[model samples]
Target: MRVAVAEDGALFRQGLVLLLEAAGHEVVACEAGGDPLVAQLSTIPADVALLDIRMPPEPDGGLVTAERLRDAHPDMGLLFLSHYAESHYLMRILEIGTDRIGYRLKEKVGSVDVLSDTLTRIADGEIVIEPELAKRLVERPRSEKRDLVASLSERERDVLKLMAEGRSNNGIASTLFVSAKAVEKHVANIFDKLGLHADTSAHHRRVQAVLTYLRSQRGDA
Candidate 1:
């Protein structure tokens, strides 16, 4: 896939370019800040654009740029490469849009396999959230006495967390050392318990389940 990158740190930007090249992806544009990248995208074509969540001139400049890019290039994939896993950041990224978008930690996404998977998922219009961020959101303490998530079993919660991380059933099964059929059963149980009917497609239900998981973190459901 063709990719454009916007990062202020010269060393990290160059390393990211090298990593993308090593993965056999074309690096079309590399800019030092969000503004330049936004300008470049007007003329250059890229399949995916990776932006640092925090960049120069403004603390959240990358996010600002992402919103603009989303408006201008609705089909292009956008991924935020951040060093922090703060809920506020994830919330902001989700506000931008869930489809063809992702937020991943810089430290963890350095792995070639993880980076490749994340980019591919984003390109395929999946919401690719960092697993660490998903875990933190899922494990955070909730103050609500009557919680819907509390009704879930331990294993169902595990499957739900992976679902929030945008893992396929096969991937979740691989991670949890279970068969795909078992993963499907757990996902079905989660949907039923969460009151998600089977009227929708399984993919739509999966997305709804993940959104439910996110809503629970804020005591909204």
Candidate 2:
């Protein structure tokens, strides 16, 4: 895949470029800040653009750039890399829209496999959230008044977690050592328990289920 990178740290940016190259992906454009990336976007035909959650020009400059990219190219895939997976950042990412988007920890994404997989998933129009961040969100305390996630069985919750990681039913089945039919059942149960019965595409419903699960647990950490 063709990739563009925007990061302030020189060494980290170079290292990321090397990692992308090692993973057999092309780094079409590399910039030290979000502005530069935005300026060069017209010329760079990147399948996926990787941005640092925190960068120069401003603290949330990367997010600012992402907003511009969304306005200019709504369908472009965006993958945000952060040293820490803060809930606030995830919320902001969600606000920017969940389609063809991703948020991953820098340390975890350093692995060639992880980086490549994330880009591929984003390019395929999946919401690729960091697994660690998903775990942290699930572990957050639930409120008694509106706890849809609490209605799910343990196995269903497991399925939901993998869904947040952007895994397909087959992938979840393989991970949980269950048949694909069982995984499908669990996913259906999760959607039902979450009250996602509106007429919509399966992909839209899946995204809604994940958003509901995460928002239900979003609170003071």
Whose lDDT is greatest here?
Answer: 1
lDDT of 2 by residue, 61-120 (tens): 889989988887877899999888887898889889879999998888878887888898
lDDT (Cα, 0-100) at 160 in candidate 2: 77
Predicted candidate 1 versus true structure: per-residue lDDT over 96-165, tens digit per residue: 9878999988878787787898999899988889888888777663655136578889998899889888
Give candidate 2 misplaced runs (Cα > 4 Å): 145-148, 219-221
Count clashing residue pairs per candidate.
0, 0
Lowest lDDT 10-residue stretch of candidate 1: 139-148
Worst 10 residues of 2 by lDDT: 137-146
TM-scores for all candidates: the values are 0.89, 0.92
* Alpha-carbon RMSD of each model: 2.1, 2.2
Q: Which candidate ranks first by TM-score, i.e. highest?
A: 2
Error of 2 at 75 (Å): 2.9
